[model samples]
Target: MTTKEIAQKYVELNRTGQHMQALEDLFAKDAVSIEPKGTPTEHAEGLDALKKKNEEFATMVEEMHGMEVSDPIVADNFFSCTMKMDVTLKGMPRNHMEEVCLYHVKDGKITSEQFFYTPPSMN
Candidate 1:
């Protein structure tokens, strides 16, 4: 599958709440995920680390009310999508959050993801 094809399938899966499946199927074994600087967790390397990171995120979510995913913009082996989530986390106030997730594909699998999102308040 080409990058555009993978990105299309990824977007479709995410819109249908099947993003975890996409991750398992389309991400490379050595994929890396990066969060913005100054966050509690910054980088997650490899599929196992990705799964652990996702588990951590799930543990923090008290509720996920809704989510909206944007169409992916593709360029060569790169793609990007923006997602808005309405969620409430354990011990945190509920908020409408937006994140721009950028991805790079190699050999038909997602090789890396870097997310740009609103930083959480520590107050």
Candidate 2:
């Protein structure tokens, strides 16, 4: 798949709440995920580790109110999109969070992904 194809599929899966499926189908085996500094799961290397990170995150979510993913902007072998989610964590108040997600594609698979977002205050 081309970068545009991968990006479009990713956005479609995410918009439909098929995040894990997207990861499984689109990411390379050694793909890396980078989160903002100071976050609990700041970086995950390898598809397995990324899957584990996602699982752990799911355990922390009390409820998911909604999720949205914007159409991707493709450039060369890279693409970017905006993701917004409204949710409440186990011990935190409900909040809406938005993030810009950038992904790199190589050999028709996602090689790496980096996320940019301001985390909501736990209080």
Candidate 3:
């Protein structure tokens, strides 16, 4: 897949509620993830750490009420999109979260990702 195709597929999968699958299919094994600064985990390197980080977030969410994925804007090897989520965390009330995610594709696979979002206060 080309950069555009990979970016599009990433959006399509997430829009269709296939979050995990998107990572599994589009990301490289040694991909790096950067979380917003001041977060518990600032960065995760490699697929294993990424998967574990995702699982940790999943465990925090009691329910995902709604989600919105914006169309990606692709440029060469980079793509970006905004995502909004309404979720209820374990023992916490529902909260609205928004993030702008930037991805870098190398050799037809996502090699790095950085997410910008406010840190949600967990009750």
TM-score of each: 0.95, 0.97, 0.94
| Alpha-carbon runs more than 4 Å astray in model 3 | none
Q: How many clashing pairs does model 1 include? A: 0
- Per-model tally of clashing residue pairs: 0, 0, 0
- lDDT agreement of model 3 with the native: 0.92
- Clashing pairs in model 2? none
Best-performing candidate as measured by TM-score: 2
1-123: candidate 2 lDDT, tens digit per residue: 999999999999999988899999999999999999877789999999999999998998999999989999999999999999999999998889999999999999999999999977655
lDDT of 1 by residue, 1-123 (tens): 999999999999989988679889899999999998876679999998888888788888899999999999999999999999999988889988899999999998999999999777746
Return the top candidate by lDDT: 2
Q: After superposing candidate 1, which stretches have Cα over 4 Å from the reference?
A: none
What shift in Å separates residue 31 of candidate 1 from its native position after superposition? 0.3
lDDT at residue 106 of model 2 (Cα atoms): 98
Which is the better candidate, 1 or 2, if ranked by lDDT? Answer: 2
